[model samples]
Target: MSTGELSDERVTAAVRDATAAPSMHNTQPWRFRYLRSEGVFQVRADFGRALPHADPDGRALHISCGAALLNLRVALAHRGLRPVARLLPDPGDPALLAVVRPSRPEDGGEGGGGEGGLGALHPAVHRRHTSRLPFTETEIPQALRTALSDAARREGALLDFPGPSHLRWVLQLVEEAEARNRTDRGEAEDLARWTRAGTAGTSDAAGAAAAGDGIPEYAFGPRRFDGRAPVRDFAGTGRVSGRRAATFERHPQVALLSTVKDRPEDWLRAGQAMERVLLLATLEGLVGSPATQPVEWPDLRWPLRDPVSGRGQVQTVLRLGYGPSGPGTPRRPTGEVLDIRP
Candidate 1:
């Protein structure tokens, strides 16, 4: 289909897929605006949903928007259009993270076709979820690991699967970060405001006001009673009446995603890279969860980088293996976040 034939329904569907991109605490911190006249979609950050304490510099916010941006590109590719994304298009407006224009494929037909193309991973857009549940001890195949790394590289980022010693040290940093968050008042408030308690899906009046954007109780997964996997407990110190405790993997297969430079543009690229890795993993029959607890702290985040190479900024930590996919979290309706203008 040509850009001239772009329909409102198509734009809305693409935005819906974009919203499925994971965010810090399921905040869904993004807004979409389609310029019908120009056939472009503006991806903006929703500061109202920002986590000031956890993401003070708005790095995570930008990453979240970047993930959505990648999904939008994938959605467009699946619909037989080629997506051209310009990052941080307007420096004057930092919130306007990106503007994506969908045009006809260069081949004058559907975009690239192959297991490695963006179109190939389009189905995983809706299937991918952040599984916080216990993953088995089975190690991911080297071939699959290489593919996941390539996915990150395609978007200008690096994905590293650390050795045993590095993995252990990274886990320790994650534990330390979690400990600090427990005592940090600001972080505590962020959690309380974004986490839903009581019945899994039932939201109180206060939660209703925010629409469906926070992490629901059911998606929190079981509390970590044993094992060393770096899963952040959204329950905090509070008690969830029926939440059961389970033992996570004794040896969790974790990976660190990083980039050469640390900037708004880099974070956005890292976010896109991260989502690409995730969608590919989902398509490969792997369940994964991202843990930013370590990266949220400056000191801990610094140590997460490679001790040998000592290059690249660690953006986020990921744990992947064979396990049940986590339940889908709440998302704001498409009408709530998208604006179309002629």
Candidate 2:
């Protein structure tokens, strides 16, 4: 723990905190390499776990990695260390999403400490889970909404709680996107590979639920018996035996998280902003889930922007409210995704 060096133990702990980030289908398509000589941690994309058809352009994959990068920053900041990060630092190396150097506070102020103030959100790193279950009809207070909006802004993104008319339009877009996914063979196959219910029977729920990756049966939440809530039915058209069906809220609250641009850097920023908003929401006693169906399709994505200003490209759709915290999803072990430089 010297001024110019970071201990192995501390770096490993930060990686563990970073892996707690949420990804599309829990794919967790990212790797970390500790550059001992440079005293920096590099976040790389693991294309093997990527959904080729669903995320052909790698937008979602980058966003997931961005979330992990954000967690890494928060973990280091909480330890009173400063983390300097660069996104897409090497143009030739596309997989190299970012490189973060954890520096001491008195090291001449090289890096901005990953926005330094994020240390307060360290606890929520593990407490926040994607609750797919139905949330109560309780509307989020205006103050909390404003706070969440600010959280996204601090990370260089926008979080918009669309009005009734806009929400209805967005819901229609989501429904259409879901229907398209239903018929797309590649999309279904990709989803099947990421969901465990296809291979896990009712009796073997324990084993399937223990998997180290993907969406488990236990975390699927209840069937949307009745409501406008946009819960993605991971089961697809297949039925899950013994799964309960529950009525969801009549009017679900949804937020559209977006960035000004749609490049890889923007995607990375959106992911960090997303984690910030989610962490803040958790601290405020709220559970959140992502509805990214519409954003996956190019035709559907453009319409997601605000009609008045006609700016901001939607990256992910988020649903937030009061409800039971969703079941924990597994992540690939640190060794599986991290490589240490000698």
Candidate 3:
């Protein structure tokens, strides 16, 4: 892992590991073009992969890229290589998310980097799935919640879980957000573009279709949204006209991850933190899903502010509980996402 001498082959293998990071919809809105001569892996945000109506300014695009960058770091470290990364390396090129170079080489070591219970958790990388399904009434251990909060803090973000008293208000916000999205013509169209079953490899706006990324119909749970746990219904797309409805976890534990300031860098940081929290949850044998419908609306955005902290905008709303982990969503191969420019 020398900055002066990086191989495209080795970088390709690393890029494979980086795609494990999660985004709003498993959009995988990122591309890595490696400059062999410079030994820099240029991480670029694929605007085409973005949900234009949902993320007009490409904030989510940057977050997804940031998550990939975090994965790149972990992948390199897992191989005993510390990659030198410059976030938003070129302001002139806005799509340029980061440039990574395999530097500070070392022997991968005797299972030292990934130690403790986390060592076991590392394997969850391949097992982690964004389950759009509901959880059984099975309760989650309180200890695991502590671990999740710790994981978020490790990446410079905080979690705010609402108490029973605040549940009614929180649900109000979620309802308001849902209502707004239902009427928002642009968002509905954008979702339709991304959620089509035929998008797998043929449809023009197949979005994550070819990549085998994004939520699939099998995982969309029920078309009907049960008020019990408050899960995000991707069924809103209306593509699957008729789908079975299942009983979800009675009380799905929902939490918000946020930063003190709302900015591109902050979103990136929050995204990285979100990935860690998710992986940690996966390690604990739990499933996590996202609900951005509320955060996407201006009217419902600031209302999610935690009463205690009284700061930071809610970047993500997650439903965490014990349930069967999701399936392996599709992804673009290493070659498609990683470019080696000699």
Number of the predicted model whose lDDT against the real structure is largest: 1
Q: By lDDT, rank the candidates, best first.
A: 1, 2, 3
lDDT value for model 1: 0.90
The residue ranges of model 3 lying beyond 4 angstroms of the native Cα positions read 1-6, 105-112, 116-121, 198-214, 225-227, 237-242
Between candidates 1 and 2, the one scoring higher on lDDT is: 1
TM-scores for the candidates: 0.96, 0.94, 0.87
| Model 1 residue 295 CA deviation in Å | 0.8
Across 190-247, the per-residue lDDT of candidate 3 in tens digits comes to: 7666554533233433453454666665556665445466666665746565576777
Q: After superposition, how far is residue 38 of candidate 3 from its true place, in Å?
A: 3.2
Q: Which stretches of candidate 2 lie over 4 Å from their true place?
A: 1-5, 106-116, 198-206
lDDT of each: 0.90, 0.87, 0.71
TM-score winner, 1 or 3: 1
Compose the digit string of candidate 2's lDDT tens values, residues 205-309.
656645779888778888888888888888888889888899988889999999998999999999999999999899889999999999989999999887878
On a 0 to 1 TM-score scale, where does candidate 3 land against the true structure?
0.87
Provide backbone clash counts, one per model: 0, 0, 5
Model 2 score (lDDT): 0.87
* Residue-level lDDT for 192 in candidate 3: 66
